[model samples]
Target chain A: MRATTIHAPGDIRVSEVPDPTITAPTDAIVKVTAGCICGSDLWPYRGENPITEGDTIGHECVGVVEEVGSEVHSFKPGDFVVVPFCHSDNTCAHCLHGAHSVCTNLGMTVSGQAEYALVTQAEGSLVKLDEMPDASMIPSLLALSDVMPTGWHAAVCAGVPEGGTVVVVGDGAVGLCGVLAASVMGAEKVIVMSRHEPRQRIATAFGATHVVAARGREGAAEVKEITDGVGADAVLECVGTDAAMGTAFAVARPGSMVGFVGVPHGVQLPVQKMFQKNVGLRGGMAPVRRYLPELLDLVTSGSIEPGLVFDSTLPLDQVADGYRAMDERRAIKVMLDLQG
Target chain B: MRATTIHAPGDIRVSEVPDPTITAPTDAIVKVTAGCICGSDLWPYRGENPITEGDTIGHECVGVVEEVGSEVHSFKPGDFVVVPFCHSDNTCAHCLHGAHSVCTNLGMTVSGQAEYALVTQAEGSLVKLDEMPDASMIPSLLALSDVMPTGWHAAVCAGVPEGGTVVVVGDGAVGLCGVLAASVMGAEKVIVMSRHEPRQRIATAFGATHVVAARGREGAAEVKEITDGVGADAVLECVGTDAAMGTAFAVARPGSMVGFVGVPHGVQLPVQKMFQKNVGLRGGMAPVRRYLPELLDLVTSGSIEPGLVFDSTLPLDQVADGYRAMDERRAIKVMLDLQG
Candidate 1:
């Protein structure tokens, strides 16, 4: 099977690798129809995150089930499924408590950017479509595996109240999806902190009523002004950098929450300010499996077009170019056509 | 007029001071029936917090309204009222949003440990009782001014669900009050971390189902053991020290929230661990004015006896003894007899 592998920072390749097979009774193999690169993937590509010499990368995919183990009950061969970035047994304590990302039997999808991927705990983590949809729906469906659901997690954690104002502090695919989620959840005003025009257009289309291109305190000031000096009712922190974290807290009003999804690095939480203003911090790697079903419904119904974030697409064999585009900021997110 | 003043760290004295008068249209002077020493008051007494040579210091009191400014409407001259530690207009943006502690017109109670105290924002900050109750209920009413409502804020911010398990990481008056709040919020299991037999008894009386006397990781382990390897459904960080914060997060389950009320000092937020567990941190200085009405109803209806936390009582002239007793942990809380 041909799969995407990283040899080192800036060295992504697509080559023939050993095929993934059912190693456990709860596992299933899926022929991936499509996959996409995530903002997190750039961490290793940029050497910010340590990586092994060659490891299969990518955690987002929509695919057709090829085979399943005896114990897998929810999915079987020939079924179209959306695989969550993290697989979990829904019966586990954490999963039942709606913390599937930390499920007792939790693990990640294997070889997701390959022709075929192995999904563990398939009974709980894979969401099967009732029937096949148009080929064009693949990108949006694929998004549910990670970005869409992740974005929804941010909004949910931030507690975006109906008719309230929301600030999304990032311009990545997930951030754009956060704007969409806040809109869907009925935020009257959605503010996006983005400097790029292309991403700003997508944000506007996704229901962002304002865009503040300023960085740091300047951006926060603009949001506060828009919110009539009260700051945002909810803040979605899609970027994990220290500056982004600072900005998220800065624009949050008293009693509001800052929902962060980006993996934080070297960020110091503003405890005193948080304590004084009654602001809260909540978020992490999203429980994608828990949120996938609802978001899938909205995608299939055409209420949202999250696939718009896939500004660049390429064949699976051209995986290196995909990484480059995303790494160099030439693309918001890159979709890989496994079928091609 | 006589008032409690802090001369320096560990030095408190009750001496002659200029009598407080109505200074604003929103001001109301109260003839204090009872005033209490809060855990926070000990901060300056212990030399942990800086104190000026002579500053009037108490913020919790219940009294009869002796005078009101022209603009005061909700409170009358003869009404018995609960003076919240933080005065709020209850009409500002933050107040309307349920964050009264950060109200635009917010201030602190003035000279509450004296015969007469000045309460700003009288129409909004003071909750007038329908009728003056017996002297026995005065202490309980005073508790509502700070500790009880502060505890309720912790439970509310932690998002305590019906029939959930709750852990309170302190055994002070506020934490005991938290046990009561969690129980009232429908938690099936209430755990308090306490080492003192006296405070533990108060916790059990306040609806604590379990008491773990261990500190730090050991305390967290006991909580987890009691929870059957899972952590508490909700945790209240009533102690603001780093150890208490650590134990609160350590014993919390994934997807659970830790509501912190103690004034956090020298604490480092466990952002990475919090992210990985999907545990959230939310809380701060409580908005007492926002929660006063319901809590006052509970206190007055005999459904709750938060006054049980006041194990010691003293005359107004014994204010120095009250400070020493509290600083030495000789009492759970001290109630000053302002009218004696």
Candidate 2:
């Protein structure tokens, strides 16, 4: 089986690797139908996160189950499913509370950017589709595996009230999806903070009522101006940088909340400022599994086109190009067609 | 009028100050019947928070309306009321959203530790009592002015679910009050972290199911042990120091929340740790005015005795002794009898 491997910083290659097999009673083997490069992947790609030998890459994908272990009762071979980014038993106290991202049993599972990946705790981690989705709808379905649900989590956790104003910080696929989530969730005004024209267009298509191209204090000032100096009712921090977090905090109205989903790195929250403004902060890894069912319904009903985030698609062998395109910002999301 | 003034750090005196008069159309002059020393007030008395000349020291009090400005329709002279520590118009966007602590039109107004204190935004800040209560009930009624509501805010904001486990950090009057709040809110088990014997007794009386007399790591470990390693479902952070905050974070269950109401100073949240655990941190200055009505009802019905925290009482001229007893931890709280 061929899979993406990072040997060193910026060194990503599609190399032949031993195929994954069912190793636990609750494990299942998934033949990857589609996968994509994540923004978090850039962390190791940029050498910010060190990579060791034989480290499997991606953590997002949608696939068909090829084999299941004895204890896997929820799925069978050939079943189309959305593989949650994190594996869980779904029975742990955390998972029962809808925090599958930090599931006490299986924790977080990786190795989805491959032809065949082993899925642990299959019963709780796989969201089976009612039937095989159309070939064209695969990208959107794959999004429910991680980014879409993450964006949705940000909107929901931020307490985006009905007919309220929301500010989305970031222009990546997740941020664009946040605009869609906020819109579908009934936000009357959705503001996307983006500096790029292409991303801004995607954001508007996804239901962003306004776009602020400025950065930092300037961006916050712009949001304030638009909201009559009261700021937005909620702010979704899709980017995890300190500057992005700062902007999210600054543009949030007093007593509102800022929900962040970006994997934070070297970020320190201004606690005093948050306290003074009575701003609540809540968001971490999204409970993707909890949101997959509803999001899949939305995709099937044609209510949201999250697949539009994938600007390019490549064969599994060309996964290197997909990574390069995403790393270089040439593509919002690069979907890898794994049916080769 | 005689008022408690902090001429300098650690220099408190009962000095003659100008009588407070109605300065705004929304203002009222209250003849303070009682006032109390707060844990936060100890900051200036201990020289941790430097005080300047003529700085009136307290922010918690209950009194009778002595005079009302033209726009103050909520109260007339002789009406008894609870003056919430933070003044608010209750009509601003923040106030309307129940964040009275950060009300836009009227910011925090101090000067409660005096014979006469000015109450601004009277219509929204004063919670009028139905009738003058017995002398014994005055302390409990005064508790509604700040500590009681602040503790209630911690439990409420932390989203304490029915029959869940709760850990209250800090054994001060507010922390003890938190135990009562959690118990009344349906928490089956309330764990209080305290080392003082008297405070522990008060905590148990206030409905603490268990007491962990450890600080920092040990305290967190004790809480974790008591909850069978799942950690508490909710944690109330009543102490503002970094150590107390750290313990609060350590004892919270994943996907649960930690509500903190102590005025944070020099506290930096370990965002990465909090993010990984999926713990939500929410709570700032308590919206005392918002919770006053319900808490007053509880007091009137004898459902809670939060005023029992006031272990000592002194006359207005002995305000310095009240501050001393609280600063030295000799009393849980000191009630100044302003009428003497």
Candidate 3:
């Protein structure tokens, strides 16, 4: 098997790796169909996070179940599925409450950027599509594995409702998808704050009623101006920076909600301001598993096409180019065709 | 008329001031019967906040309406009323949505320390007591103006449910009252985190099932241990401090709520931890007007006694002593006798 391995910052390569096999009674072997580079991947790739000598990377994928362990009952051989980044037991109290991201028995068993990966807690981690998807549906289906679910989590956690005005803070793929989620959830006005023209176009296509190419206070002010000085009813913060968090607070109307999905990068919420503005902050590692069912339905029904975020695609062996293109801001998202 | 004023840090004095008169068409003049010192007052009194010149202080009171402006329809002369801290018009969109504290008009007519107060939006700010109360009930009635309602807001915002475990992060007057609020709201386990014996005693009397003296991480651990490692379902942060805010987050279960009422003092929320925990944070200046009517019913029926928070009393001429006692932690709250 071959996988994308990270040996150091800015250094990525596709190298030979041992094939995955059933290691637990609940584990299943999956042959990767399509995978992608995620924004979170950039953390370790930039050397900002601790990286080992040869760590296999990737946590998003659309794959086919090639084999299953004795305890796997819900899935069988040769079923195409979308796998959430986080693995859960599906029977724990937390999972029962639909908070699979915080499942009591959680694991990262599948490396998405590979030909074959092991998936633990098979019944809970894999969502089998009703039918085999066309090759063109691969990227969009793969998106449900993480990005789409993540964006939906941001909107749902913030309680975005019909006729509400929603503000999205980042221009990344997840942020763009949040605009799509808020729109799908019935938000009347979807505002995306981005300076990038390509991402702005994707956001608009996803139902963004307005786009503001400003940052910080100016950007927040722009959102307020657009909302008739009441600020946004819901804010989705996908950029986990101090500036991004500040914008999230500044642009929320009194009693509004801000859902943050980006990993914090030295950002702390201003409690005093949050209290004064009566803004509610709910976010963290999105429980993407919680939204997979509905998100997959929407994708299959053609109500949304989140895969439009993938501006560039490459073969599994060319994973390095996908990283380079995204690293250079040349692509909103990069798709890797593992089937080839 | 005379009012209590703070000329500088630690300098409180009772001095003659012009009698309040209606300044707006919706304003009314009230002859104050009771006004109590709030924990928030200690901020400016202890130099935590700047006291510029002789600024009149206090924001809680019950009084008799002496005069009403032409636009005032719901209240009139000779009516006994409980005045909310914020003077909201109640006609604005925000007020109509139940966010009276952040109303668009007349949000800052603070003259609660004087013998007579100019209350803006008389119809909205004054809640008429069903009947005039005896002198002994004045203290409890005055509480309905702020502390009691603020405490109720904290519990309600935290979403404390029946049979739920709730952790209160402050032990001041508001925190103590929050215990009563949680109990009334049917919380099964009300745990108060307080090291002060006085406040703890009050919390216990108000129905705190468990008390933890530890603070910050240690306090959170104690709460988790008591909750069987699941953490409290709701947390009321009645104290406005970084340590208190941190404990509120650390002690809550995932998918729970944290309602904070303490005016934030240099506190910053841990966004990453909050997100991962799936905690919902909601709080701010409480819309006391919204809760006063119901709380007044509870008080009038002899079902609750929020007045016990006032541990001391002083004549209007001894206003300086009242401030010193509260600032020096000798009193949880002080009641002022205006006629003396």
Q: Which prediction has the highest TM-score against the true structure?
A: 1
Q: After superposing candidate 1, which stretches have Cα over 4 Å from the reference?
A: none
Report the poorest 10 consecutive residues by lDDT, candidate 1 chain A.
A105-114
lDDT of 1 by residue, B1-340 (tens): 8999998888889988998999899999999999988899988888889988888989999999999999997788899999999999999899999999989998898688888899888888999889988988988899999999999999998998889999999999999999999999999999999999999999999999999999988888899999999899999999899989999999999999999999998999989999999999999999998898889888889999999999999999998898888878888899999878
For residues A1-340, could you state the per-residue lDDT of candidate 3 as single tens digits?
8999999998999888888888889998888899899998988888888888677999888889999999999899889998888888878866776678878888774478999878888888788977789988888998988898888888987789799899999989999999999999899999999999989999999999999998888888788899988888889999788899899889988877888888888887787788877788887776767788888888888888999988988998888888888888888899998867
Tell me which of candidates 2 and 3 scores higher on DockQ: 2
- lDDT by residue (A162-247, candidate 1, tens digit) is 99999999999999999999999999999999999999999999999999999988888898899999999999999899899999
RMSD of 2: 1.4
What overall lDDT goes with each candidate model? 0.92, 0.89, 0.86
TM-score between model 1 and native: 0.98
lDDT of 2 by residue, A167-238 (tens): 999999999999999999999999999998999999999999999999988989999999988889999999
Clashing pairs in 2: none
- Ranked by TM-score from best down, the candidates are 1, 2, 3
Which portions of model 2 show Cα errors greater than 4 Å? none
- Residue pairs clashing in model 3 are A283-B275
Q: What share of the true interface contacts does candidate 1 keep?
A: 0.73
Give native contacts recovered, as a fraction, per prediction.
Answer: 0.73, 0.67, 0.65
- Rank by DockQ, descending? 1, 2, 3
